[model samples]
Each structure stands twice: as C-alpha cells, then as structure tokens.
Target: MSAARPAGPVGGVTGCVFPPATEARLAPARRIADAVLFEGYVLYPYRASAAKNRLRWQFGVLVPPGYGRDSGEHSHQRTECLLEPRGPGGHLAVELRFLRARRRTVQRAAAPGPDAYLTVPELELSDRVLTPWDEGVPESVRLLLPLERLTRPEGVEHPFLLPARRETEPVTEKGAPVGRLRYATEEVSGVLRLRARELPGPYGALRLTAVVANTGGWTAPPAGADRADALPHSLLSAHLLLALDRGRFLSATDPPRWAAPAVAECAGEHTWPVLADPEGGDDVLLSSPIILEDHPRIAPESPAALYDATEIDEILALRTACLTDREMREARGTDARAGAVVDFAASLPPEVLERLHGAVRSLREVSPVPGAADASGEQPWWDPGADRGVDPARDTVAVGGVAVGAGSRVLLRPGRRRTDAQDLFLDGRTALVEAVLHDVDGSVHLAVTVEDDPGADLWRAQGRFRYFQPDEVTPLEAS
Candidate 1:
C-alpha cells in the first residue's frame, strides 16, 4: 500500500523523542514562514486497545526539500510525515504527539535525527496529527501495520510539494541530475521510451525499453471501440536506492552496480530514473508512485491491528516526507490514454516507439516480487483469483472486500505470513493475493483460499505479500 515512514538516515539526526515543551513551540522546522500549506493535513484516529473503535486515518502525502544547501548545488531535502491510524478490524492506532524529545537544530534542511524534520512548505503538523491518552506525549505509532487500501491515490503524479500553482517540470537537468533530458511527445506514434542499458554483471545502469509516441493525449481508438476502462497504461518500474548509504532508483534483478537498485525485479531491464519526478519550470511539485488510492468504490473508515505492527518505522518516515521539487502543472493534462506503445519489436525504429507516446501511455504498472525469489511465488498482487485481478503471473489477489478499510492502500486486504521460493521474484509482473493472516488465541482470521497447503501447495486465487519480517517475511522476493 505505499507504506513508507523510514526517514532516519537521509542527511542525519532525527533525535526528537518528544517532550521539551514541544521544541520551544511549533518546531516541525520553525514553520518555514508557512511553506506550501496546501489545504489539508489532519489525522486523529485512536483506539489502540479499545474505546469503542472507529479510528480511521492512513494518510501519507509529503514533498518538502524546497531547495537550500546552496539552492543551485546541494542534495539535501527534508520533509517527514507519519499518520497510520487503523482500528476496527485490522487494529493498531495510538496517537499523542505534541513534539519535544530533545536535541535541536533547525534553520534549513533540518530533521536528520530526532524524528528529523526540515520542512518549509505550507508547514503542517495538524496540532497533534493524532493524539490519544497522552500523559506527557511521544506515543506516535505508525510504522506500517494496517495496509489494505487506506487512501493513497493522487495519480497523474505529485506525491507532495504543491503550491507553485500546481507544480510540474524538471524532466531532468536543472542543477545536476546526470544529463540526458527531453520527453517531448504528441503521440506521433507510441511514446514511452527509455533507452540506456548498463548491464555488465551486477547491472551498473540497467534500463532498456521503448514505447513512446507523443507526450500526452490524442490517440487510442483500436482496442475494439474501447471506452469504459479504455486501457492503455504504461509503466517501466525500477527504483532502488534505500538511501542509507547508496540509494536511488531500484527494482532489481542484479542491482548493486555499486549503485544498488533491486526492489522488485519483474524483469531485468526496467529503468525509471528515480521516477524522473519531472522538471521543466513553473513552480515545482513531484511524487506520485502509481495512483488510484481509491476511486468511488468507497467503504473504509478504519480496520487495522493484527497484533500491533510497531508503527512501521514511523510509517517509512512519513513516506519520505513527500519528495519535493517545486513548480507545478497538476500532472499535465492528466494523461487521457492518448499515447505509449512500448513495442520491443515494432521493427525497432520509427524513432523507436514514436518518441514519447503520451509519456509511454502515461506509464504506471510495474509489478513487484523479488527480494530474493519465491515467498510462495504467484497468486498475490492483491489476490486476483478466478482471474479478475488480470494475471501477469497468477492474478491480482481477490480484487477487494474480504476485508479492507482505511480508504485505499491499494484497496486494502492485509493478511499474510509464511514464505520461501528461493526468496521470490516476478519477472512476469502483476500482483494481488492480499490476506493470509492467521492466529486465533491472539486474534486474526482472514483466508480467501488455500485451506491448507505446505508440500502440496494450494492457495490459489492470485498472490503477493512481499516482505513481512516477524522472523522472515519476503513479501514476494525473486529477481
């Protein structure tokens, strides 16, 4: 579901445990004058043990790094957030944050340690963001534990940093991004290109594929008079750079080209360039992993807690505090399925895939399953069973409904355990299989299929949980 609150070693120093008077006063970084202050930021869904249990909130939208160190040269961005509020069936929701745990330092790029926070845009903390039964304060638990669709949609891209009007630019090269830039598109053909393969052994570069056309809207009328779903999505997926020491763009098959990138590996040549995030000029705003956190199918207020998950690293440091780039565009036309072909063999040229085909059909469908090999192998991308989940390898997991509340982590379906398949990998793509969650004397029961299969192997209906960690949860490894 996009659960990432692991912001501990980006720059250094996030030691605020909480309780020094809330850091003199406001302190998420002195407010930065008011930063981008979009329009939303509020989370308060309690009931870690019991109060009545309603608690809802699984938000994550960060994009800080307004640019400082030198402004023109310097790689230091800081923006941290963590909400995690799930309770009703999934469980795990205990708030209480007033700020103040000691150790300070804030003038810019702050929050490297002490919960680390160097935010500036729009300045938002939501008072307590979420508080409950606080004696003094420091009870901030949200390290990922209630995933099953809990609101994470805002597609077209733009994870955080919105204010320049909307933000959208920086296709690459503004102050040191390596070089090579220009996506320009009109769908002259298929648009979605990406050529730059560096594969000697461990993959020093790893990136190869082309399906481009134009850049946005203007094509698509063949799938057979298609209209409803209109289908034509394009996504290359590949970004691995955990950032503890060496991180930047990963999706692996043989990563660590001294660069380290092998997060899912559905193939061996994908390439995303850290998402390109985009950059042209106007204002700036970047971050948007996929999209469709939820689209009208409603039905989620809360449902977390399988036995307490431990805050999930503060929710991956609030999902990387947003991403930040600045300069807006909204998402450029939003991508009306006008371009993106991705033909590995349309003869191989015509400018290859036509140049930029709606930015590669708007690119956005790169599956995952490769931390090692086979946490169980197929049938788990959300649980696509009977085959509604699509089936790139097995299926999507179940589609939705067996149990998923919060809003849209992907449509919620949290429940799984038990792995091993060389580790796991998905060179095939497509994921689903969402719940398995066991244990009774303690609480937890959500199965869908697989009445029982160990040596026999039988729990079909689509699968993919990739990486748990109570002892050894691969999540779906294999690249």
Candidate 2:
C-alpha cells in the first residue's frame, strides 16, 4: 500500500512503503488512509536480511471526540491504528522513537531532548511480540482510550503518562493511581444517578462503562473498607459503551476478526451493543493508581444500576396518583420537612402494600386471550430470565386493551439468589441472580448479571418476585 502524504512527526523521513518482509513486522496491522503503520517500531541491522541491534518504536492512541467519519456507515469511531516510516532513518547506535500527543511541551525520557523515549516494565500481554499497529478492535459502543507505553531499559520513563486522569481524583501524595476508584452522581428529573469510575494499569486502555438500575428499596452501597452497616441490593438495567477511531482495524486479539467497519470512518455517537472479552485485547490504556472512599451519609451508596423510562411497570399503586409531572415532583419531594412528615415507603400500611403488590401481580399474570398457546414459548433464545415488561399483562399496561411486546420491566430491590425451581435452569442449576423482574408477560424473571453499572446489589430488599421476559432472554444452551 502507498503511504499517505501526511506530515511526519517532528521531522520528515520521506516515509516509503516497506517490502513484504519489513512490512511483515507491521503485519497483522490495520489499514491507514493509504498505508499500514507498524504497531510499533523495531530495530536491527540495516543489511537487507540480517538482525542487528537497531531501533524500533510504536505508539498507542486514544481517539478523542470528533474523530473519524461523523456520519453514515463509519460513524462513532476512534480507530486504534499505527503509523511508521515507509523507509529507514536516524543513527542505529542509539535509537529514538516519537509519538503524537495532546498539546504539551514534550517531556524528556531519561535519555535527552524532551524525553525522547519511554519504558514500561510491565505490559498486559507478554512474550507474543506485540507488533506495531497489530492490536485488535473491540465490539463495544463507547470506547474510552488512555494509551500506555513500555521502555526497553529500566527507569527509562515514557513521556505519555503525564496527560491522564484530568477528571480523576488522585489517590495520595505517595500512592500510584492504579487500583483506586471514584464515585460520582448526576441527577436528572429528580432522580439521582450514581456512577463509579475506575482507571487501572499497564496499558493504554479503552473506557468501560456500565449503567444499572436501583430496583431494590435502598440506594447502592459505597465502596471502602468493609462497612458492617452497608446494605447490599441488586440493581436493574445495565448498558455498556466503547468508542472507536477510523473503521479500518481488526478488533479483538484472540481468534481475531476484523471489527473495522466497511465504510469510511466517522466520529459521533454509535453503539457497539455486545462484545466478546478475550477476542478484544485488554485495553490499550491504563489508569494510574487511586484510592476509593465511600461516604453514604451524603447519599446512599448501592450497586451500580441503570433504568430507562421504558420499564416502569411494577404497578406502584401510590395511595393517590401524581397525575402530572408537577404533582409527581411535589409528592416525591425530598424536602426535609416533607421527608420528616411523609410516611416511609417501608412503613406503608399492610392494606396499601397488599393493594400495591396485588395490582402489580395482577398486571403481571394477565393473559393475552385466556391462555392462547402462550406465544412466549421455547423458541430461539427465549430465556425465562430477562425482564419482559407488562406485555403479557395487556389488560393493564397496554393501549386500548391490545397486547404489546415488552412495555416496561420492574425489578424488586435487594438481590435474591434463586432455588433450583425459581431461576432459569442452566445445566439443571438455578440461575444465579440479584434482580427482580415484572413485565408485560405474566412471568417474573430474576436479573442475573448486568452489562454495565458497577453499582446495584439486590441483597437489601426483602421477599419480592421479579419479571421474566421469555422473548428477550439468551439461554446458556443457545449461547
């Protein structure tokens, strides 16, 4: 392939297309605009065929917002790729490499000239010669990048580690930022959304985010040294996101397949949905160390969870309906005065509780037409474990008494493990879970594991049934 005529880093080396042998070094690499960059660089004898001590270098990149194709097929990408000389360069006695970084006065390595080199004593993958630009892609929707580098010699610090975690809280004066975690909260529509952020080790990595729902009664528990008083509750929804650059690279490292999109790349929002872990390389980024602290007096800390407007069907029969958003807000007020006088959700009278649970269950078990073939039978990928909103209960959450697919899903708070008969039988074993489910379908399934959101545990909630969507489940046998 021809090398694209983009300005070279620092100095121009008249990049050229390397022969197959030399190109093989950059083998297993992805396509660039016109050429393929070696994942990193390598050095050896210049003798057309012999291996001598030569210089080699490579760089990992984290594509920021507004990167590749912004529309059409290649939207939402920060493709992980490489760039290198099409030809040779510099003195072989002492080798040097360069990488483009966010704006900064280039820092120097132990060597010279603004830290010309970098070193990593450890990396995620070893022995398997991590060739330049040879890294694979991941099938995730929101991809966050923090690239890490390695050094050939000890103490030779690479300059890239400086520009990380502007958004993260530092661990301590003496602590490395590797294992530390952070918790944050954002409120919308009077609901407090909790988030836990973590950055950890050894490589320039991808961002991993999970969103869950607070199905249980209490809030998520804070993370810190064991808190004897912490309440554990399972969460509801979870959604994961990963980002990408141009759509020209392979994703995943194991049995690797091309994750590159077929059209020109674009940058914007997109969703990857589902992904395989082993196939996708461990992130190309690493977060420095950090310390985690949980403070619940400020806000109840609980398991990470996510909830969307689509699934509110558990039939919460309030003593009176709010009717309007304003009324809802007033009734749900968090004011200290209101809180002091209002009855706690747990303290509601037995009649009210019975009424509420009964209404919800009634909605859950309502059949479409007096038991017509239970359209939700054993079909392809119908696990009785997913949250199938009030569809099966058409008489309640439907329009004009017509049956819908899965209008909303309701999960009881506080996780509950299942007995053999309770959960979806996986190899004859009860499915392990911490979620409560209530959907259009009469059956209530349990929330097993979610995709994102580190918060949300269901251990705190008392006895309550969950929703089960027969159509949305992916049974182990099918997978």
Candidate 3:
C-alpha cells in the first residue's frame, strides 16, 4: 500500500483461508494490519494537485481481468506459506481485506435545477473547501473452514461481488443546497481459492497456498487510457489475514534447517506471508502485498499513522507542524484523514513531540576494555565515537600489494555489484583516498573523492567522500 511498488509479478483465487477467531484474538494484529492497509493512503502536504498523489495505489493493485495486460498490472496475487500443524484436527479463519476506489467530482449549480448543474474542480461552502479527488472505501470478505476441507485435491473456491453504486451529497449554504459532490464506483468481482499439501520434511510441515483474483466484469480501457480510468474496477492494497485453532506457521524468511527445503519449493506471487502475532505466537500469519519481517509491530511511541510507514515519525511530524495556513487548508480539503494529520501535528504537546524524537527499543551489555574507562568513568556504550583506539586518518588497508590510507591515490574500479547507478560513470576515474574505515561488522572500506570532480575540495573539507570496498579499487600510490 505504498507509492513505491515492490519488484514482482502479481496473480489470485479467493475465500476464507484461515480458521475462525474471536474479535479479541484479532485486535492486536488488526492494529498493525490497519497500518499496512493505508500505508500510502495520503502523504505530507496532502493535496489533489501533488504529483505523487496523482500516481496512487502502487501496492497490491488487482485490475479487472482483460485490463491487467493492457495496464501492466496483475489481476491476481498468490500467497504461499509453510505451516507445521500440531495435529490433524485444525481449522483456519481467513480474512481478505482491500480497498475499493471511489471517484468524487465537484459540481456547481446557478440555481436548484437538474439542467443548471456544471462540473467544477473545486468549490467553497462557508469555510469548507471541496476538491475533486479519489478516495478508498474499505472492504473485507471472510470465511472459516476445517483443515480437512482444504486438503481436498480440488481445494476450495469462493466467489464474491461488491455491487456498484453512485451517490450525490449536497453542498449547503444556510439551509439551501448550492452545489453537490457526485461519488461513483464500479462493481468489483473476485474469487478466493485455498489448497494445502504435505511437505517431504520430517517436521510434518504443509505448504498452504491462497490465491486472490479480480474477476470483475469490466472492459479493458482503450489504447490511450491511463490507470486512472481503470481504478474503479480495481482492488487496491489487497492482503490476507489468517488465524488458526491449532498449528504453528514456520517463518518462510527464517525457517529451521529441516523446513528450509520445503520453504524454497513454496511459490508466492506478489504477496509474501509472515507471522502476524506481535507476542511471537505463530498461529496467525499475515500474507501482505508488501514484504514484512516476522512479528512486525508498530512502535508504541508513534502518535498517529502518517500513511508513510517507512518514514520516521519525528521528521514527518515536524514537517506537518511547519505547514503554512494555505497548505494546511489544501491538505484538509484533500481528505478527512489528511485533515486529521494536520490537526494532530498542530495540537502535539511538547512532551508528546519529544517522545516522537526518538526511542531505544533494545539494550545490550558490553564487555569493558582494560583501558576503556578514564577520569569520566566508562564511556556510554551507545556512543561509538568514544572509542579512542579507532582513527580513520591513521588506518591502512591492503589493496593490490599497497597500503592505502588517508592521502593515498587509487583508480576507481567499482565492482559488478552496483549499489548506486552513478558508480557506473565513476569506473576508471581516479580518486584521492581520504580514509580507510572499518565498520562495526569488521569490514574495511575506502573513502575517496573523485580527482577530477569540481567539488572534490569542498567534499574533502566537509569530510564527505564516496565509499568503496578494498576489492573495488586498486591502489596507485601512498602519500
């Protein structure tokens, strides 16, 4: 559900794929799942005119059958996960969640007559600002099934349809209607299919596959039509939630040695499955369109969901708090959720803002060095700069039978593993080495500035240099 799409192909078949669980059982995971649900629903400086906002719905988009090929988006997505059931008797509650697109257009009228209406991009009623934009409505389809039912050779299939509709809300001045907003949506149809097969491992593991597809009956857009024209017929940010009565799901990402083989055999298209329970139990698995680690949880220090999960709360909050009145008004008019973010940022107390500044999620004991302590006593373990033994300027690394350190010269030969695209242009260029550094993991790196670069002196003065592994460069001379 982010603006940046993950690299992969998408596929689908649908129904309940997990066992039945009570509301209380789902409450914890539901909170984290909601964050995933609206990960990029809106962004900072939220406005309909923003370029980023115009290209929305980048994750788990399921366009109608024939339209996918034309639009370069998939109509379905599949989730393949490994489960180690404790016994043969087990049940699963499957919940499919996604968003349906709603197209809202502002309209104006000179008088209260049907023929007097004229389409407009925006309109103001009193202090309220209205603008034309796309909005998402949440939808969920769920089912529960016995483990035996899913074991059948044919598996199980369930088809569903969300009917289409059109709505009109009046814009009023005093008691009379002045203008109206028209909301239109298209019918969405999809099917869910679930199947389970036993693995060859000693751990009685089973590979479970769940597929969700878009079967909506909509014609493909014409040759020149863009994705915006097909949004109404698509399922936005689709993902699955599964709860089990008995059985533990092995992590597909970090499975035990024995189950690794089976995990490799499991095929997943577009979506990935990870353990969902924040408490570390494996009974729940979230098959999301966006990749996530096992037992993912939101930080408690966060005050609100800003729709950009990858960004830091402190930076986003500060940026939102600094928005001018005009920008705030446009953001408030963009969507109700955007308006809430603006209000939350403006109302944050000093203490609450400080909390968002930072938090320590973990701490570890460090073994003291004989001479690590001084007059001020032992340095704080969190301060890496306190280590007096390390000096980048005096450090040396062996490259091509030469000691390369500060003031050394080298030929830039960046390796095949292209970490940055700009590295391609730097290959074969000469550079002046600024430092030989060792990371916390004990890997050596050379920091250098391009010899021919106009800003080389400025970069060297600011202590900023491009970094490369020892194997990526050949030493030419040592200063």
Candidate 4:
C-alpha cells in the first residue's frame, strides 16, 4: 500500500548526495554522510560546475555490489539514516522517497528488402529483466514511462499479437537474465513504494536502512547490448521525505537563531555532527539539538528568530539593483511563471529601494576577481591610494581585539579538523605579520610568515605566507 502523505506544515533539511557509480563501500558512505551534515550543504547560486559544487554528494550514497568490477556476481546495495525525535516518550514515523532509474532493453527489427514484407508465425519469445525490489510490495508503483507499441523507421507500429508474460526470479548464475520480455515489449519502467515502520523509541535515536537488490536473474546479451553495457542497477535520489508526529514536534529547515551565538564561537564552523555508527556500523547519528515547545527556557520568538523580518525588502532591493530595464521586461516574456516571480520581486516597498541599491553595490564590491585578472585585482579600495609612500610606523589597528601592524607577532586560533585539508594548521603557533590587508567586506586580515622557519620569506612571490581573519589570530605581547 502507498504510504500516507505527511500532514500539516513540516520543516526539514533536504539535499542531494553523490550516487556511487561503482560498488558502494563503507569509506565513501561515511564521507557522504559527513558531507551532508557539513555547513553549506548547498551554496547559494547553485550550479553544477560551481567551485562549491565540487563538494557534491554530501548525503548518503549507495551502489549495488559488483558494480565497476570487471567480473563478479552483483549483490544488493544498502543505505541507512539515523534520526532523533524531540521531547519525552512518544511514537514517530517517517516516509522516505527517492528516484530510481528504470531499465528497459530496446530492440528494433532489421530493415527488410523494399519488396519484402516482414511477417512471423505465432511463436513465444520470452525474456526476463532485473527486478530490484522485494515481493508483496505492489508492482507498478510509478509510471515513469507508459506502455506503448514499438515503431519502425517505415512508420509501422508492431502490435502485440499475443499477451506479454512477466515473472520475478533469482540470479543463480553470473550474467543470467532476470526480467522476461518478448519481441513485442519495447521498453518498461520500474516503481518503488515508501517503506515505513514504528521507531524503537521517540526520544532516543532510530536507524532506517533502505536495501536495494537485483533479485531477478537476467543475463545481458553476448554483444550489441547498448543498454546492458553498464550494469542495469537501480539508483536512489538524495531527496528524503521525513514525517514527524503532529503537535508533538517542532522542525525548521535551518538551525535556530539562538544557535548563531554557538555557531560563531565554534572553533570550526560545523553546526551538525556526522550521523555515523560509533561501532563502525552502517548507521550514523544526526547530532543537532531539537528544540521543544514546553522547554522552560524556550523563547516564543525562537521559531522566527532565524528568519529576516525584512527579507522581502532586501529581495526587492536586490532585484532592482541586479536587473536592467530590458532584462526586467524580458523576464516577463511569454512564460507566466517567470513573469509572476519577476512581478513579485519588483513589488517591494519604496522606502527600501535606496537601501537595496546600497546592498547590491556592496555585493559587487566583494565579488571575486575575474579569472584573467592578476593578484592586484583583489586589492581593496581602502588600501593606500595614489599616495603609496605612507609611513608604516603611523599605521596601527586593532585586529581580533589586539593591536597589530607590520612587524607585530600574533598567535593563530585553533580551528576544527577539516577533511578538505584547507584548515589553517598554525593554531597556537606564533608568526610575524609582514602586512595587514583590508577586504571589501570591511574585514581586516593579517598576512604572516612562520616565525621559526629559516626560509620564512614573504617576498619570494610564491612563499608559504598565510592570511588569517581578524578573529582567527591574536597579537602576541612583547616578552
């Protein structure tokens, strides 16, 4: 049976994870789980080729065994997600939904001579295709493709002269055919139903695993099997649908605003923990505190605190600043949906128009330098202008609550462990500030070289000089 849809307003985080093109392994699965919980799971201005997009597949990933292997019997793939319900003891249920690719073997009859008409006597042609899901889970869960007749180049539609046959079987031998199909069957699609069950506990953690296997035995053709070139295995989409008991739970897409203070103070910017099993199992724990309604210290504005009260004003301002008259007119062309979005963006308060322009101007100022530009292009406007010969002794500023300037020594703050290897590792280490630079965002940063290194040269043009934000360093006092 189809699972019931989630009722009432619901809030939760949803994101895409990388699918394993080959066999799903434990290391990659763990990494995927960690990535999904990482901050900035998906960045603004989402594009596939964006720099941020390189960090794709932060969610859980699963792949059938024997995938990407030269020769091996394929086995089922499994994925698990761990969840924690808020508040005291109560029952909880969740619905999982994901996209699975449908596999079908397409065949076309060879061309017959101009004078010849293709005809065949009544004969049975049976073949089995792979079936990925278990039995008793009603078939035809979704119609990704409707059943239709196959057409030839001559525009002749071949009719199914006899009833088609289908059955599910196991893959007892390597490279065995699974789903049975006849000459009349051109293509087919597969469907999956939501699997739900009661959690062991409401307040405690629960693990959910989705297992996919090619239970049917289907052997690919010896040759010319374009569809079978790659193993015909099902895939799961990253979108997950979660349902919580009504009136007993509170959910939000983003962390609450009160979380901001903690986030800022965090040595590393990670706001969520990797939900992996401590015993090296497939399941992982999702580690974010769930706010409860009746908590003694819970504030009424907690729910709305993270949201900007003037979001519409800011968005309207942004629209006016970014879109030209021609572009605005073009946005309304033909497509009613596009026009509606543009109209809504344009309908902002008049009082915020000036502020909107200012915001846009600031955004442009901090935009990244073009690829063709040299290092000088990154220089901020606040740097010394035409009078480039300013006295160094006269320039002094406070960074991270400490006085600093050229020749000043500072200590780097410890940062959390990072997988990207980009984390500044000079934590607690002292360095000499060779220069202080300001960026367009009105933030000060220090360029420093290691104090003890013999080759500590900042002028080599390609030396290991590092820049740190004001908050990431503190001025070292004189001995």
lDDT of 1 by residue, 285-361 (tens): 11112221111111121111111112221332222222121101111111110000001121233342233232323
**Winning candidate number (lDDT):** 3
Point out where model 2 deviates above 4 Å.
1-240, 248-310, 313-331, 335-479
- Model 3: residues >4 Å from true position, as ranges? 1-21, 174-176, 221-224, 365-479
Evaluate residue 124 in candidate 1 and report its C-alpha lDDT on the 0 to 100 scale: 15
Give RMSD to native, each candidate. Answer: 29.6, 27.1, 7.5, 21.0
**Candidate 2 lDDT over residue span 1-479, tens digit each:** 11112221222121233344423322222212011122211111111111321112112221211221221111111212211111222100000111222111111133434323333221112111111111111111111222211111221121111112112222222332221112221110101111112123332222222221122222323442121111111100112212122111222221122223311132212222222112233211111011111110111111110111111212222322323433223322211112211223324555544533322223333234433334465222233323243233232223123322222222223222433343333222223233434544545544443323233234224333233333333233211
Better model by TM-score, 2 or 3?
3
How close is every model to the real structure, measured as TM-score?
0.15, 0.16, 0.75, 0.26
- Candidate 1 regions exceeding 4 Å error are 1-41, 45-195, 201-205, 208-479
Worst window of 10 by summed lDDT in candidate 3: 1-10
> Which stretch of 10 consecutive residues in model 2 shows the poorest summed lDDT?
287-296
Whichever of 2 and 3 has more lDDT, that candidate is: 3
Task: Quote model 1's TM-score.
Answer: 0.15
Q: Order of candidates by lDDT, top first?
A: 3, 4, 2, 1
- Give the higher-TM-score candidate: 1 or 2: 2
* Model number with the top TM-score: 3
Error of 3 at 306 (Å): 0.9
